[model samples]
Target: MVRERKFSDEDLFLATKELLLDYGYEGFTFGLLAERLGVSRSALYKYFGNKEELIMEFMMYELDQFMDKLRKINDYNRFEDQFDYLLELLMNHPQIHQLIEIGRHVPVNNQKLKEKNDKLDGLHLDMYQSLVGFVQQGKGEGKLKPHIPDTLIVGYILQSFLVPNFAQIPHSEWVQSIKEIIRNGMFTDDH
Candidate 1:
């Protein structure tokens, strides 16, 4: 007979994240998770009562990390620099992209999952607002052109990172050039 293996909270959390990335929210289940770990379903229940609870926990953990990074940015010279830094962070997180892709299919049963998702969404919205606020501050400080509205500034910043064509450019050079262009358009005074 084979001896049973015990799993800790950290083990469960890591397994849950990996399972979610592989199978997505709709496809993942306690039984599936247990099987993946070569454990019994009861063992999974001990850590997570249901799929919704597990998913919410995972999402909240990721959201917390994202917020932490946002709070730590202090040295950038301009809003675009901040935006580029954020873009680089996002690009490096392949797991986050996978989780986001999986999130779209997450099942909504009880209000808890929805509540957690709503909270994460609110954080993302707050980040966008911060980006807009940064641009507004830049204009007031004369670091950015006054003609560009906050909305356009934020939108364009996101577009540059999200759009595949420009996304290919290396993070460092892209950020530097974008910051320069945002402050001063192509064709300088000497041109």
Candidate 2:
């Protein structure tokens, strides 16, 4: 009789995400993943053909989790509350943007990789729609200025995640300051 697998797909995906973030794509290896999961390298190959397949699957998994949280923003009655929730979501998953950047360079040498890239593109469209809807709602509710374009608002929100902290500010303070800057312009009322 065949033995049952010890770890679930979730277990593998979570471990892969951590390793990818720490080691990046160039450094990531099946050996490291197998060692981290307490499984043999061949055992991993049974699930994924190679690192690219594993990484693609992992990205899909992470995107699903992210989409779940993003959908919850609609439950809030106030745009301000939704905006705060959105900030928390983005800040909590700072590596998402990095993962996306990594995905850009992910070689598509097979049909499976092409399909995965197409699916990822669909997820990106869904995310963009959700963000646009949120911005539109904020504008209608007067929480966001009418003159500011939705694309600009969304871009600013996304770019905020990449802002450098050269001053070594505390995470809490940095987040709070970012929230303030996003909500209120940098210039004082006197200006």
Candidate 3:
């Protein structure tokens, strides 16, 4: 009979995110993960063959979490409400962007890792589909300007987190300011 794992996948994934963020992909190792999970390296081996498999699994968890929350944007009927919800959601996932970028660099030497990487790519497209739909909805409702390309709008909204917070503005205000700029141009109606 197989023995059960002492730690839950949720616990392991949480620790994985923390450790990966603290120490980059090259620096991350099973020894470090074992220490974080308070388990022996051999214990982890029972779950994954190597660090790559574990990291792929962890990325899957992250995508599932992000996609779950992203699906909720449909709950809000109004474009403004959807916009607000998305902004707030994006704010909460500040590190996710970086995490996803890291996932992109993970090498896929074997079939399993390749499959996981392909799934990750599919999920990314699904995310873009939702975001594009959101933009299209706004355009259809006259909430967003029709002249501007949907790709540009979607790209801006998606990359908003990349803007450096060098000014040290409060999070709420910063997000609000970004919303205003997206809704209305910097020059205002007068210009």
The candidate with the higher TM-score, 1 or 3, is 3
Per-residue alpha-carbon lDDT of model 3 for 56-153, expressed as tens digits?
A: 88998898899999999999999989999998898888677778878877899999888988998888888889999999999988889989898888
Model 1, range 1-191, lDDT digits (tens) per residue? 97655876667767888888777777788888888677898876666667777777777677567667765554676655765676666555535545655665666777876787788678767666666766776787776778867788766655544435444777667666755665566668896
Q: Candidates sorted by lDDT, descending order?
A: 2, 3, 1
- How far out, in Å, is residue 146 in model 3? 3.5
Q: Estimate each model's TM-score.
A: 0.60, 0.84, 0.83
Candidate 1 residues lying further than 4 Å off, grouped into runs, are 1-5, 74-77, 95-98, 111-118, 131-191
Regions of candidate 3 where Cα sits further than 4 Å from its true position? 1-6, 164-168, 185-190
The per-model lDDT (C-alpha) reads 0.68, 0.87, 0.87
Q: Which structure is stronger by lDDT: 1 or 3?
A: 3
